[model samples]
Target: MSEPLDPGPFFHGTKADLQIGDLLTAGFRSNYRPEVVMNHIYFTALRDGAGLAAEIAAGDGEPRVYVVEPTGSFEDDPNVTDKKFPGNPTRSYRSVHPIRIVGEVHDWTRLTPEALQQWRDRLATIAQERGEIIN
Candidate 1:
């Protein structure tokens, strides 16, 4: 077997309120493209990256970042790794299996309103341009 890509105390970000032991599974809609039902659940080793995902996740609920443990093997996310940012600098991964919520983190840095708006505007532009999600 191949060696694992990352030894992560991984994190998943979302706007959903969740408790410890909750299982985050694949088949959810993509946060970036609602039209796509994701085949894999994505996570990252970088806490701040997860924080950014949580902030931009599509929902009315408050953003949350959860410490998660993958229930099965995972691989580097092709969407960002090599495809966009080379060398997996984002430390992102995706799993077809579920990831269990081990705990919640409360101290992640929040984006400023302007920064958030900038991200929103960027996403909007991508959507308008019909960017592919590499699902």
Candidate 2:
């Protein structure tokens, strides 16, 4: 039998208050444990006229989803955080092109794609198993 995958994420909070950037930050900080390098990194959002509205008009810090591939530090550490959403949201940053990183949010993200995928796959399996997703 194959070894079990890690339990991905529980999402302790609600999406009601969560925004796009919230998801990103939280995803990055998810792998935090004892005696780790903490990944020692930062992100710079891609700025273009397309996705600037939501970011600018955000009450304080609104979230805009985006399609982000491993940009930086992806090569440095195998743990460079990357998240994938099959059911892309309408409000997500356009094509993941014009991106923007919200100023200093919470240190709330994880660093394991395998675990993330495991959880995502499991959740979908459960939802499909229960017919939560309509065909």
Candidate 3:
């Protein structure tokens, strides 16, 4: 008789297709971290996140593409004026800027050209929308 199918991985393929085998799947899956903000949106979109992350890594085993976290405060309101008091500071908020390798880019730049361009174009669009200079 043919050998039995190798029943494997505790949780299969990206919860489905990506789950090829247990050992491999394990590397690809993890429990959501409690410290995660954004309501763990990143965790919920694991497949897409992983794909993007893989693209970012560019096979160099380094995360090339990353959803970067902004520091301190952002330029959320570039219009914030000094017309406010001390407690009422007018700090701009930039949220976060998802970046792909520019100076130190990842190899995935080639794999997902469309995505990278989309990101660039999106920023351009936002800049245009905000009447910001796009040079």
Q: Return the top candidate by lDDT.
A: 1
lDDT of each: 0.92, 0.28, 0.28
Off by over 4 Å in 2: 1-104, 133-135
Q: In candidate 3, residue 115 scores what lDDT?
A: 79
Q: What is candidate 2's TM-score against the reference?
A: 0.23
The residue-by-residue lDDT of candidate 1 on 87-114, one tens digit each, is: 9998999999999999999888899999
Give the local distance difference test score of model 3.
0.28
TM-score (all chains, Cα) for each model: 0.94, 0.23, 0.21
Ranking by TM-score: 1, 2, 3
RMSD of each: 1.3, 16.2, 18.5
The C-alpha stretches of model 3 lying farther than 4 A from their native spots are 1-42, 53-61, 64-111, 127-135
In candidate 3, position 29 carries an lDDT of 21
TM-score of 3: 0.21
